[model samples]
Target chain A: MATRVQAAPFDLAAELAGFGQGPKVGAVVTFTGVVRDDSGTLRHMEIEHYPGMTERAIAAIEAEAAARWNLVDSLIVHRYGKLAPGEAIMMVATAAPHRGDAFAAAEYLMDYLKSRAPFWKKEFTAEGAEWVAAKSDDESALTRW
Target chain B: MIDVLYFAWVRERIGLPKERLATSAATVAELVAELRSREDRYAAAFADLDALRVALDQELSSFDAPLAGVREVAFFPPMTGG
Candidate 1:
């Protein structure tokens, strides 16, 4: 498992392909999160994450997933710095011997990351900027794991 | 002593991204209370506990959990960390 925190866009296809070692690992689940334009409702969004802590936190999540699943490879690419609409913001890929493991692990990582990781997102709208309210649904998702 | 970190909205409210602190708190909740007592900034930052999340030594954990032997305690907005 690997987690890269950088200011540049990542190549998700290449990342997932790298895990293609032996033929036994047949499944690959990839997720790409892109910046979406919320019309004028959202002018822009600011993402804040702990510098040293972001990497450490992400690695811990990956490690937990690796231990719980039969995964062969996993990659988490999260971008920082100023970003615009339609830009790639983050990606997650999981490879395993079976699709079920790969798919579930990838989804699990994403849901948990959204709810448990230490990142804050502030949205800029027509009126002004505001922190998106944390939802109860997100916390409930953690119980699924 | 531990390196305490704040991220996202927590940083915005606290006006700092990171800080170091020596504490007597035995649990994360106690630390949060300690921070809230420090100054107006910390009080404002930690005002809404429901909107906050915590990590001990970089691993997400409950606020009531012990932090006696931890190396770090991180406070942040409910994560959008993907």
Candidate 2:
């Protein structure tokens, strides 16, 4: 398992090049989140995170997924800093002997990362910038696990 | 001394990112109360307890949790990360 908190953009292809390369690995699941300009006026987004806590929280989330799922490998890469529309925000990958475990663990990591992680987002637009509020749906997603 | 941190709007509202203060408060709630009484900026930042989340030494915690051994305390709105 691996977790990374960085300010630099990650190459998805490069990240998955040798990921989950194991004889027993049968399935791999990956998810990527990107910035979107839903309001049309969005210029960019600024992501802020607690340096020490961000790494610790992601590590703890990864450990929890490992404990709950039978997997061969897993990786979480989340980025912070200025990102324009369509820029990748984060990605999660999971590998397991079965598709079910890989899929479920990937989803679990996302749900926990949404609410448990320390990162916050600020949207910049032509008009102004505003901090993104936590969604009730995001918090409720944790109940699934 | 405890290092107090504010993030996002809390940081913006308070006009600073962090500070070191010697506090005698025993719980997170008491710390909030003390900060709220300090100035209008702090009061505005902590006006609604329900809107905030607290962390002790980088670990998620409750406002009622004891602060006996915590070296750092952070206050911010609910996380919106993914």
Which numbered prediction scores highest in lDDT against the true structure? 2
Off by over 4 Å in 1: none
Top-scoring candidate (DockQ): 2
Q: In model 2, which regions exceed 4 Å deviation? A: none
Candidate 1, A99: how far from true, in Å?
Answer: 1.7
For model 2 the local lDDT of residue A22 reads: 77
| Candidate 1 C-alpha lDDT tens digits along B1-82 | 9888887778878998778899999998899999999899999988888777788877778889998889988887777665
> What is candidate 1's lDDT per residue for A1-145, written digit by digit as tens?
7888888777766776666477778888889988787664766677777677678878888999999999998988888766677778899888899999999999888987787666667777778878767777887988989
lDDT of 2 by residue, A101-122 (tens): 9999999999999999999999
Q: How many residue pairs clash in all the candidates, one count each?
A: 0, 0
Across residues B1-82, which tens digit of lDDT does each residue of candidate 2 receive? Answer: 9999999999999999999999999999999999999999999999999999999999999999999999999999999898
Docking class of 2: high
TM-score of chain B of each: 0.93, 0.98
Chain A fold similarity by TM-score, each prediction: 0.90, 0.99
